[model samples]
Target: MPKHPIAVELEAINRDGETQVVRDCGLPVQGYSVYLRAVEASGLALATWIADYDTIGPAYQLAERLSIALAIPLTVLVPEPLMPVQSGPAATTGVITMAN
Candidate 1:
């Protein structure tokens, strides 16, 4: 069966986020990718991104690219939310909360 990218990617996100990593078959990959495909109520894919991995360089780059691709802003929140607020796109607008 040819697994849809959205389904495969969503499984990876749910697994990794809950377990903090994907573990199965004893030889699990060290890191996983969160491929987000946001679609509207009309079944149109609005945006997508491979987010929040150990190698943030790729994710970060993808965020930037996806922002342009989707015409929607991308944002990231630091772990230390209490830190002094520095003005930035991710810091100010486009609030996204992850459950993990």
Candidate 2:
């Protein structure tokens, strides 16, 4: 599966003076990309960097839904969270690297 971009709020305040802390509530723009078929025939590529693997699965799931909901194709760059490796350190290495 693919990963979704995050929705982030860069500043503490907008022109309105109040800033929206969407850290948990939303994702950063770089975290996800929205591709409209009508706009681009090939569609947009999924993002490779993500906030965490924890949300990778959900991001892909959302992409699938968006594809159907918006009638456009969406791809998530990150793969779904995998089961813990029984090998301990060896398996954890990849997870840690990707997280970074």
Candidate 3:
């Protein structure tokens, strides 16, 4: 198999001081892809449901139902919020004064 640039190497020392090398198979995809691939590779059981970014209200409810039906774990990927950027001294100024 080809090597991945971002792959991490893990070594575990047993009681006899024996070292074991661990190989990672699913480190490339994100969100649903990760769960789906893991299931397909026999590393994990079937993924009944998955909640992608921006899943809210009804979407969450539906996922739960599917999870129960398929007897698989429900994966939810919460997205990060974006904050406004501040630039210059006026960025924090709530009010501006004009020269009279």
Q: Write the per-residue lDDT of candidate 1 for residues 1-100, one digit (tens) a residue.
A: 2222221121122323442323233333333354555556556654334455644345445544554555554443222221233456643433343223
Identify the runs in model 3 with alpha carbons over 4 angstroms from their true place. 1-38, 41-55, 79-100
Once superposed on the true structure, which residue ranges of model 2 sit more than 4 Å away at CA? 1-53, 79-100
Q: What is the lDDT of residue 29 in candidate 1?
A: 31
Kindly list the per-residue Cα lDDT of model 3 for residues 1-100, writing each as its tens digit.
2221211111222234333221232222222211221233434334221333222334434444444444445443322121123366633333211111
TM-score per candidate, chains pooled: 0.35, 0.27, 0.28
Clash totals in order: 0, 13, 0
| Candidate rank order under TM-score | 1, 3, 2
Which scores better on TM-score, 2 or 3?
Answer: 3
- Candidate 3 TM-score over all chains jointly: 0.28
Q: Pick the candidate with the highest lDDT.
A: 1
Cα RMSD of predicted structure 3: 20.9
Please give the distance, in angstroms, between residue 34's alpha carbon in candidate 1 and its true position after superposition.
4.1
Worst 10 residues of 3 by lDDT: 3-12
User: How does model 2 score by TM-score?
Assistant: 0.27
